[model samples]
Target: MNDEASELKPSPKIDPRLLELLVCPLTKAQLEYDAVAQELISRTAGLAYAIINGVPIMLPDEARDINAVTVAQP
Candidate 1:
């Protein structure tokens, strides 16, 4: 049986080799792996692509705008 805490712990789903090979689909630029956030940050594209279930969602539409700012409504 696996330890409950260990099982619950979150781990990076992406592979190191794959990370090196993967790039921003839009800009063809290098991507920075964010293990904590489970995303690939593309500075050139100014986007953060979400990695779900060990799969990187490289689609632009699904990516979050890293440069976008959200203002709180008072």
Candidate 2:
């Protein structure tokens, strides 16, 4: 496949309702979606849960520390 075709391939999309339903496992706080990173960020918990193949892996052990993530400023 051509590079353009590969770039155009659709990525798995998470359901909006599911995003609303999920929370930070450690803090019980609401999560913010980092669509570009495919992660659910929990500022309160200082962790980011990964979204794989449209499924959210909410396990704390599977999460990356939010402090380690560098978000670009708009």
Candidate 3:
């Protein structure tokens, strides 16, 4: 398959309600969806949790540290 086709492969869909119910395990803070990256970012915790097959891998060990990713203030 071509790169475009591979990228378009169907991934599991996460429910909006489920997203609303999920919080950062460490901080109990809300998560923002980074759809293109397939991650759930917790700004308060400075972590980005991976979403595998549409299932959020909420484990702290599986999350990437975002301390180096600077956010622009309004």
RMSD of candidates 1 onward, in order: 2.9, 4.6, 5.4
* CA shift of 48, model 3, Å: 0.2
Candidate 2, residue 42: CA error in Å?
A: 0.3
Q: Assess every candidate by TM-score.
A: 0.83, 0.79, 0.78
- What would the TM-score be for candidate 1 when compared with the true structure? 0.83
Give the alpha carbon lDDT tens digit for every residue of 1-74 in model 1: 67997779786579889989999999999999999899999999999999988899999999999999999999
* Candidate number that wins on TM-score, 2 or 3: 2
Model 3: per-residue lDDT, tens digit, 10-46? 7666788999999999999999998888899999999
Off by over 4 Å in 3: 1-4, 69-74
Q: Which parts of model 1 have CA positions greater than 4 angstroms off?
A: 1-7
Sort all candidates by lDDT, best to worst.
1, 3, 2
Error of 1 at 66 (Å): 0.2
Residue 22 in candidate 1 has what lDDT? 93
lDDT of each: 0.93, 0.89, 0.91
